[model samples]
Every structure is written in structure tokens, then in C-alpha cells.
Target chain A: MKARIRITLKNGVLDPQGKAIQNALGSLGFAGVSDVRQGKYIEIDLAATDEAAARAEVDRMCRELLANTVIEDYAFELAKP
Target chain B: MKTSVIVFPGTNRERDVADVLAAVTGSPAQIVWHGDSEVPQSDLIVLPGGFSFGDYLRCGAMAAHSPIMRDVVAKAKAGVPVLGICNGFQILCETGLLPGILQRNASLKFICKDVWLKVENTQTQYTRRYNQGEVARMICAHGDGNYFADPSTLDRLEGDGRVVFRYCDPKGNVTAEANANGAQRNIAGIADPTGRILGMMPHPENAAEPMLGSVDGRKLFESLLAA
Candidate 1:
């Protein structure tokens, strides 16, 4: 099974990379770009028995390594293809 | 004093810190590799500055998960004195061993220059060498040195006097220019509750040797020795 973990800066936290992208778009003739925020998308292969277990493990992984709970939020999903 | 400097692949200032440690402690500081799962027994642990793990994902993010960091964290929790320089400061935050994060400079540029810092609280083990309210010249080089934490956290830090250093002008005025990275509350350095672990954006090691420019940084190392 494969799972994807999405991590984002917590609400109200400044996102410099996202702001830079927004600025870049505005300069490239793209108009009315209200805002942009950059985040991470990580995919991992796992052998969990079910979706619930996979998600639980991914959450653990995020807390342990992928996401910094102090400043960032993370969620993961297990999907079969 | 037994001293050890952990050397991650991208750590550029391990030698500089080692030299300072040797000069001040009268004993050579061991250079520990990042791959090592255990930290050597030492009275002090120095996490020197560099773009650890190339600052991948986020500055200090990857290195925080490095094998050596686990050992470092364990030792820190056990009351061993740990000092983190610029990049090391980032790692400390990422590891959740310290509060707050190092955000990018408000000016959106990497700053490399001498900076003046006011000794906020001299009671901590890290700043005991400096007179309370005295100012010292130090070097800061980082793109993401702006420190940010929630309001409550900031209040607790201030209330507890854990804030040990702040940016200041040569005249010792806390001004915007002296705040090289525009950190929240002008904070430059902080200590753990026990004051055993210190994370600061300024690189004292860089200024420890007079030939490098200023020897003002020696006071910090001296403080650690006295501790």
C-alpha cells in the first residue's frame, strides 16, 4: 500500500516560501492572485494490513519525523491503486 | 572539562568550535560523527554551525532526525550542558528540544556580519561570564534567524527569565538595526528551563579568536567552563 502525508504550516504562521511563490506569480503577469502557501507532499510505501492502521502509522511518522507540531500541521491518507 | 563537538556532514564550524573549546578548556574537544548512534561521555556538547544536511526540507529539519541528534537530545534531557550555534540552533528547534522556530529574515536575505547583543539575563550558566546588562560583539550568519513563538510561550519565556540575549546597538540600545533578523521580541538566545541547554543564533565560536576579528565571544565559552 502507498500513503501520502501532507504537511503545512500551522494557521497564522508565516510561510515565506508560499509568499515568495505568490510574489513570483504576480510578477509573471498573473493577476488577482490573492495568496499562496507552499507545503510538502510525501508518499511512502507501507505494508500495513488496512487503511486505518496505515493512517495511524503515518501520523506517528509525521509526528516523529515529518512534521513539527509546534509550527506545522500534518495529515496522511492511505490509498490503494 | 570533557568536551565533544558533533560534526554533521554539512557542519562547517566544528573545527572553529573545537579550537575555542580547546583554548578555553585546556583540553581538545572530540569531534563526533553524525552517524554515531551514541554521544561520547562529555561534560559539554557543542553543536557547531553549518548548513546541516544542506538545510533540506527546512534548515535543521533533516539534521534533527539524524542519528546523532537522538543521542544529543537524550543527553540534554539528562542535564548535560548543550550549546547550539546558528544551524545548531535550528536543529534544536526542529528536534522539539527547544521552543520557537527560526523563520526567514524579514528582509529576505542572508545576513553575515558582526552584531551587538545585550546580555539579557546573566544568571544562566551560558551567560554567567558577562555582566548583567552589558553588551558584547558577536557574529551572526543566517537566512532564517528570526525567532518566532506563540504569545503565551513568549510570556512564559520572559516571565521565567529564560531569555538570555537580545540584539543591541553598539551603544547598547535595543534597536531595529541591531536585530539582524528581526526576531520576535528582539530575542537572540534562550536557555532551557534548567539552563543547561542553550540555543542562540549568533556564532560565538566565530568571534572567539582575536585574529578572526573580535574576542568578545570568549566570554561565553568561559562562562560554560565556570559552569
Candidate 2:
């Protein structure tokens, strides 16, 4: 099985990089760009037997290494090959 | 008193901190490599600042997983004094020894210069030499020094007085002007709930000698040595 994890800075947390990009886009003549929030997409391959097991393993990976729970939020789902 | 400074690849300030430990405390600190699993038995363990592992993935992320950190974490949990500065502070966060995360500066630029920090709580073993509210001059050099924590965690830290230091002006006033990194509530340093482990983004070791322009940072060592 394969899993895709999306890690994002939690809401209400300041995202400096995203803010910078938003500002740059505004200065470059791109109007209507209200905001830019950045997040990471990570994919992992696993040999889990079922979707439930794959989801659990992916959550473990996020908690252990992929996401810092203090300021970041993460969610994942197992995808069919 | 014996001391040891953890040395990781790409740590630019290990020697600087070691020099301060030697000159101010009159005790030469050993340089412990990151590859070593065991830290030498010593009175103090310092995780000095620098772009450890070139700040790859995250600041201090790789170094936090270094072999010696397990020993450092063990000793810290056992009540030994451990000081983490700059990238060291980031390592502590990664190791779960500290409560907050270091984010990029609000200005989106690397800040390098002398900054003032006020001692917010002095009841810890690491800060007994200074009175609460005394402002000390230290230097901060990093791209990621802004500290962030969830509101509940911040409230807990504030309620327990774990916040040990705040950025300040030279005259001892806490002001936004002195907050180079825009840390929440201007926090510059914090202690573990037990107060034995300290992680701060400021570089006190850099200012520990008069030749380096200030000796204000030496008080931290003096306090620990006396204790």
C-alpha cells in the first residue's frame, strides 16, 4: 500500500514562508492573491495488509518524524495502487 | 568543575562556547563528538549554537538524533544541568526536552547581532546569580529564533514561570524594538518545568568574555558553578 500525508502549519500559527510568498506575488502584479499557506505532501510505500493498518502506520510516522505536533498538523490516507 | 561541549558536524560555535567555558569558568570543557553515544561525566553539558547538519530538514533536527543526545537527554532527566543555545535550542525542541519550536524570523532574514535579554525568572539552578528582572546582554545569530508554542503550552509555561528570559532593550525595558526575531511574548529562553534543562535561542556563551565585548553572559556559568 501507499500513503500520502499532508502536513500543514496549524491554523492560527504564523507561516512566515507562506506570508513572504504571498507578498511577493502581490508585488509581481498578481492581484486577488489574498493569502498563501504552505504545506508539505509526503508519500510513503508500505506493505500493510489493509487500509486501516496503513493509516495507522502513516499516523505513527507523522507523529514520530514527519510533523511536529507543537505547531504543525498532519493527515493521511492510504491510496490504492 | 568539569564541562563538556557537544560537537556536531557543521557546528560553528562549539569552539567559541568551549573558549568561554575555559576562560570564564577556569575549566576547559571537553569537545564531545556527535558520533559518541556516551557523554563524559561532567558538571555541565552544553549544546552550543551553529548550523548543525547545515540546518537540513529542520534546524537541529539531524543533530537531535545524534548518538550523544540520548546520553545528554538521560543526564538532563536525571537533574544534571544542560544548556542549549541557538541551534542547540532547536535540538532540545526536537528531542522533546523543550516545549516550543523555533520558527523563522518574522523579518524573513537571518538576524546576527548583540541583543539584550531580561532575566524573567531566577529561581532555577542555571540562573541563581542574576536577579529576576535583571537584563543581560547576549547575542543572537540565527535564521530561526522565533519561538512558538500552542496557547495552552504557553499558558502553562507562563503560569509555572518556566519562561526564564525575554528580549529587552539595553536599559532593561522589554519592548518590541528589542525583539529581533518576533518570538511570542518576546521569549528568548525557557527552562524545563524542573528548571534543570535550559534552552535559549540567545548566545550567552558568545558574550561571556570581555574581549568579546561583554562579560554579562558569564554570570550564568558563575551561578551554575556556585550551585
Which residue pairs come into collision in candidate 2?
none
Clashes of 1: 0
Candidate 2 CAPRI classification by DockQ = medium
DockQ (C-alpha based) per candidate is 0.49, 0.72
Angstrom error of the Cα, residue B187, model 2: value is 0.2
- How well does candidate 2 reproduce the true complex, by DockQ? 0.72
lDDT of all predictions, in order shown? 0.89, 0.89
Q: Considering only chain B, what TM-score does candidate 1 achieve?
A: 0.98
Per-residue error for B155 in candidate 1, Å, reads: 0.8
| Candidate 1 wrong stretches, greater than 4 Å | none
Looking at model 1, residue B48 earns an lDDT score of 88
TM-score of 2: 0.94
